[model samples]
Target: MEAAVNDQPRRGDTEGFVLQVRKIGNSVGLILPKELVARANLREGDRLHVAELADGSLQLSARDPHFAKGMESAGKAIRRYRNALAELAK
Candidate 1:
């Protein structure tokens, strides 16, 4: 397992598992260990956000407040297109 940081111990790296990268459509995906899923309370078909760190490493996190802002923008777009959608429906 990689060195644990901070005073907290994360569940996924207790013994360090190998993740296999596979090609899915045009992008590659990594299969996370099942223990990680349980620890993070994540389930299949759930969404995860990936962030690119300054050190060239990827950070995986749950939903962020930025997503709420994006949702608000989408709501504004829906309001703006309400007339168009109504016309299309008719």
Candidate 2:
């Protein structure tokens, strides 16, 4: 099935895309168009984070802010304990 772009504004300031959910084996998924994928800077094998907004709308993003923050903190910790970690590994 094809995705239909709705020109009408939905839920205050957002536009809606009518997508068809298809069954893939035991899982159901939506087929995103190439144009949309390219516009979103997404490619094959990239991870996407899905979230449900307060209004129950689904949001998809290539990057997770929380995960990025956690990774940054972990990197700082690793750098701070590099010598200890190396000694422990020996």
Candidate 3:
């Protein structure tokens, strides 16, 4: 007989629902649940950025906040000095 499974999200993660990493051809990967994928707004081909925290924990997000902030600053600088940048580009 098979054990019953509950499909619900909780405060704690990977407790009972452990995501086992296995070899997929050459690379090892984990298979996420459909519910989790929908909650994260992730698709099959969507790119994810993984970062290691100071506490030795890993974080996964669609985009890098650090890079996004840097780009935002660069955009502001370009807008403020558009004429100067245009002259330099020539």
Which candidate wins on lDDT? 2
| Regions of candidate 1 where Cα sits further than 4 Å from its true position | 1-17, 25-27, 68-90
Model 3 lDDT tens row, 1-90: 222355333335644345556566787876677777888899999988898999998777998788999999999999999999999999
Q: Model 2: runs farther than 4 Å from truth?
A: 1-16, 71-90
lDDT of 1 by residue, 1-90 (tens): 232233232344556555555566787876676777798899999989988999998777877759888999999998999999889999
Please provide, for model 2 over 1-90, each residue's C-alpha lDDT reduced to its tens digit, 9 standing for 90 to 100: 433554322232456455567666788877676667788888888888998999998888899979899999999999999999999999
Which should have the higher TM-score, number 2 or number 3? Answer: 3
lDDT pick, better of 2 and 3: 2
Model 2 worst lDDT window (10 residues)? 3-12
Superposed on all Cα atoms, the candidates' RMSDs to the truth, in angstroms, are 9.0, 6.0, 5.6
State the lDDT at 52 in candidate 3: 90
Error of 3 at 19 (Å): 1.8
Off by over 4 Å in 3: 1-17, 78-90
**Which candidate do you rate higher for TM-score, 1 or 3?**
3
